[model samples]
Target: MNEILEQALLYDFYGELLTSHQKEIYEQFILEDLSLGEIAGDAGISRQGVHDLIKRCNRTLQGYEDKLHLVEKFLAIKGKLHDINRILDEYEAAGDNAGKLVADIRKISDEIIEEL
Candidate 1:
């Protein structure tokens, strides 16, 4: 997957850990796909200030992930799903066991997502 997509997912997964103001600015910059200049214009800060804000926000998000391990857990679950998919798809010529494995994986993934 793309690094940008991963970063975006990590941000979302850890965003609630940040202050509300940070959330608004970050969402505007990342999820909204707005440019730094655009965000700065709305936030009444300089463009460089907006850039620094985003950089600091990214660091804060990473800090939360490092401490809470929430992002790590989510990423691990996603990796497990990918592995399960590859296993099922590659053994398409196998018996019903693959179908059962896929079903089990889905069940486990659903439970994990619920906990998240």
Candidate 2:
């Protein structure tokens, strides 16, 4: 996964667990794509403080992921859905293979259900 995308996913899954001030600073750094200096200027903190806060936020979010595995399950389900879509596309292109494609879709769906 891309680093930024992974960060975004971690934040999305566990951000509400963070304090409001942590959320605000993290949003500015990650979602708003602000530089450390920019965030520090806006928050009236030192640049080092902003950098350290962001780093700490990253660790905190990652810790939640380590414990919960929500992000991992989400990504797995997403991949399964993509596989189902691909199978559907193939089924459409190969009308004679409907039975095989349908079976594939059912198998993936079963996996998704089990994960949920």
Candidate 3:
């Protein structure tokens, strides 16, 4: 996955675990795509303070991911859904009996849903 996209996903899954101040700084840096100096100016902090806060936020988010693995499971389920879609498309193109394929897809979908 792309680095920024991965960061966004991680933040999406775990950002609420951070304090309000941390969330604000993290959103400025990652979601808003602000430079350190810009964030510092807006937050009334030094550039180095902004940098350290971002680093701390990254570590805190990673810790949540490490404990819960929610992001990993989400990505896996997404890949499985994509694969199922591709299989359905192939079956439609071939005009074949896709009953067995449908059953397998349903099983996989159920497993993913149960994981959540």
Give per-residue CA lDDT, model 3, range 4-115, as digits (tens): 8878888999888889999999998999999999999999999999999988988888888899999998888778777876777677678787778776876777677666
> Predictions ranked by TM-score, top down?
2, 3, 1
Candidate 1, clashing residue pairs?
A: none
Rate residue 91 of model 1 by lDDT: 73
Cα RMSD to the true fold for all candidates: 3.2, 4.4, 3.9
Per-model TM-score versus the true fold: 0.73, 0.83, 0.82
| lDDT comparing candidate 3 with the true structure | 0.86
lDDT of 1 by residue, 4-114 (tens): 676687787888777888889889988898999899989999999988878898888778777888767777887777676677667755666667766777677667667
Give residue 54's lDDT in candidate 3 (0 to 100).
Answer: 89
lDDT at 107 for candidate 2? 79
> lDDT of model 1 at residue 34?
93
Q: What is the lDDT of residue 3 in candidate 2?
A: 89
Better of 1 and 3 by lDDT: 3
